[model samples]
Target: MRKYFHIDLNDRSIETQTLSGEALARAGRHFIAKTLLENDVATVDPLSPDNPLIFSAGPFAGSNFSNGNRLSVGCKSPLTGGIKEANTGGTFGFALGQLELSGLTLYGASDEWVVIRITKEHEITFESAEPYMGLGNFEASRLLHEKYGDKISLALCGPVGEYLGLTSGIAFTDPEQRPVRLAARGGVGAVMGAKKVKAIVVDRHKMPPFTDRKKLMGSIKQYGKLLREQPVIENFGKLGTAMVGDYTNTIGGMPVRNFSSGQIQDPKDGPLQVGGQFIAELNAGRGGETTHACMPGCMIKCSNVYVDEQGEEICSPLEYETIGLMGTNCGLTHPDQIARVNHIANDLGVDSIEVGAMIGVLMEAGVGDFGDEGFIKDVLTEMHKGSEKGRLYAQGTERVGKHFGVKRIPVIKKQALSAYDPRVIEVTGVTMMLTAQGADHTAGNMHSIVCDDKTTEEVTELSMGAQKNSAAADSLGLCVFGRSVTEANSELIVEAINAAYGCELDPSFVLETGLETLKMEHEFNLQAGFVTEDDQLPDFFYNEALAPSHKTARHSAQAVNEVRSAHF
Candidate 1:
């Protein structure tokens, strides 16, 4: 049986060690659920003040499975007044797994700023974070590398987080000590800032491997072979996530001009429709670099290092969401500009999606003309300088709308919607609104729903299923990409788990676990003061008809109400 040590940062204290077994399973569920509820209640209570954030990993985290490296960072989102779990890839999972720590629950605000370091040699130390304030991720990373060396992985927040910017993100160092990976959603960085934690560095030196090595390795080999044989996985390994840009544009699902249209004629979509345009453009001139992996021993290298005109490395892996939000939505077709923006966001420790959405909203409000790269760059410069306008942009879309006195803002629950338009891809929009995390595409990302007809009922059904599936994937510490193969026979995932853990379990139990987690989060939000009104999209989406496609938001208030009713 696996043992877990629950660390409560509420009083900078530790709880008694807990063991995970059949006897404690129900107790574990209740304990976690109660912890979550207490945090939610405290967030609203006048007497007891606390801001809680939970970091959790499943038992399968350190296993050899291809997608088992996921880590979840959950908190009440600064952007959205509900539960938010920003999942990401990093060595933290393997490190935590090696430490046999299932979850780290942090609560209460610190009087003085601090940084926590967990070394692989079973050493935990807390240090002052005063000197690290106002440092960008690149500079902070350099400082940590100089002190901790390349073997240790660090998760750090930058000046944006220090300033309590709602869109700020946490940056985690890769194995190379580059601040490349991110827990870059739902403004968890702001929550960390509020807690006065500048960084969490994990050092897993000389830690032994997982317990069930033989069974884990066998399952990993089987899944790795299955992934290698799949054509989609192979293409992902080759082209990386940016390969979806062209397909999204071609299918009229790409968000263009603040999602007013989906049809965009941007060269960023791999040039004009010449045959093999994607391949040809990739081959021409140092643009399309070789795909690479984010972590050690990752077989599907679905990431790339993008370069600019001067052969300078611009960014690591220009993705579809960045392209859609920064490229087409902002009316800028230059991949170099997009890459630069991504780099800027990374350095500033802000969410690229929110920044791009803010820029798009600004353009829509006529503050800057669409496609005006110079103005866009100027706004970004202001953000870098921490000016008033920069602060406004950093606060995000709904706040921007309030500041500018504009009601036509594209947001849900004060969070900006992502790159997919609701009209063309209705299911994702529904999920964006209904998810505990507001306006986050990744909260559900109902791409599978695009296969079905976009009727109101079908859209609702697909959104619900996608939400459940996403919850399951996240809880299992598996990448959603693996869902392409595993989603159909989800039972196979349970079988793999059973084989690795030497436990007999039915697959339905996995789904049940996910559903329970989702329900817990939702209940927490309800107690935190979220309402049915929060579960609806911004008013503009329904009233305004997006151009080119000529499709208005089809779901009515009643329809949206019905969807939320079903879920609740």
Candidate 2:
């Protein structure tokens, strides 16, 4: 059995609920959606005290299950005005699993900012957060560690989140004590900030008991073995996610110069500097880790620690999205430049994709020159200082575009579109248009699909399949990068879950759970007054033809919604 805590911040009261079998096994994203629906969270103001922030852990958490220790943070988004589940790879879920806790929900607003600490004994206490306020994630985490100890994992609301920046995300500690891993997207950090919670500290303990320890261990080994034999997994282990940029750029699917062009540099230029191959080689030569795990026991280590020419750390993970939107989209080609900005964004606990898109739009509005490092640095500085202009910039891409009267804004449902150029990445485009999760690719990304001969309905079907798989993975606290193996071997995964929790779920349970979660989210969005038109790509995508590919968005919101309705 696992304990779920309902913490009311109004009077600092805690209520615990015990869950077992299927309930505990299928937690994380599903739990958040179900709980919110039951609590009528859809009708509440997203930033109000009534809006609960949920944190959930999967059943395989704290075990040596690869990509199985992710933590899901969910709330009604202040940015998108809809359901948001932003999961991150980190030790927070592992710590919860160690303590035999499934999840926790925070209700009501605190009278003062506080650091909520959970001890090994499950004792929850609130401490003054004055000392950590206005500090960057690095300094704040250091102070938290000094006061608490090293054997605890932290979830921090950064300086940007202190004043409820819409681009802010809650930062979680990576294995190396770096708070670069974030539950990033949909203004989750703003929700945390609204609750007046500065941080969440959980004490680490030994792994919790499993129902069938020997069988679970065997399943873990089998899963790892399967992942090892997969060629795609091997490539990811070598190059990390930056390789996606290479493929996207080559195929004219990468967003370049504020989504004006699909490709950044011409092929005549030497190797694409911002792409994964170049970055891996560069980082490796500079004594940096080209492949590293975001969480403990992740065999497919697709994260990295990028460094400067001096062999000093710039950022822990210089990912493909940051490379596409922040590097190429902004007309900056150097990884070092992107890494410096990435470090600053991480320090602020803001979503780099949103921040990057915002900067790109600012450039589009003639506020700054594209590829100007000085302009980018100045914007980040203003954000850090929480100046009036900085706060305006922090409102995110869509709002900033509106303020500047920019017509070429790339956003859906009020949130900025991710690195993928929907015009060229057609199936992913369909997914972005259909998902209630705003313009998030992780909701369902099918960028690898060859869409030249495909129909809108066909692409929507493909998107639905991918979305189901992704939803299942998110609900299970599994990383989507492991989908190649996990989706192909659902039986093995279900068997592992059964061995761990003694549940008798069928192989089809994974997709079914995903479908259910999607339905719940869709229903929540409807209740929140989201219309079919809200699920659309911007007009620029339909009217403007991207260079190289010269493809405009082919799917309409109505057609995509019809297909989705048929599926449901």
Per-prediction TM-score: 0.90, 0.99
> Each candidate's lDDT (Cα)?
0.69, 0.92
Candidate 2 lDDT tens digits, 1-568:
8899999999999999999999987788888888888889888999899999999999888888999999999999999999999989989999899999998999999999999999989999999999999999999999899998999999999998989999999999999999999999999999999999999999999989999989999999999999999998999989899989888888898988899998887766767888888999999999999999999889999999999999999998999988887788888988999999889999999999999999999999999999998898899899999999899988899999999999999999998888889888988888888888899899898888998898988999999999999999999989999998999999999999999989999999999999999999999999999999998789989999999988898888999999999878
Least well predicted 10-residue stretch by lDDT in candidate 1: 22-31
RMSD in Å for model 2: 0.8
Give a tens-digit lDDT track for model 1, residues 258-300.
8877767644545533112342254346755557666555677
Estimate the lDDT of model 1: 0.69
What are the clash counts of all predictions, listed in order? 1, 0
User: Global CA lDDT of candidate 2, please?
Assistant: 0.92
Error of 1 at 448 (Å): 5.6
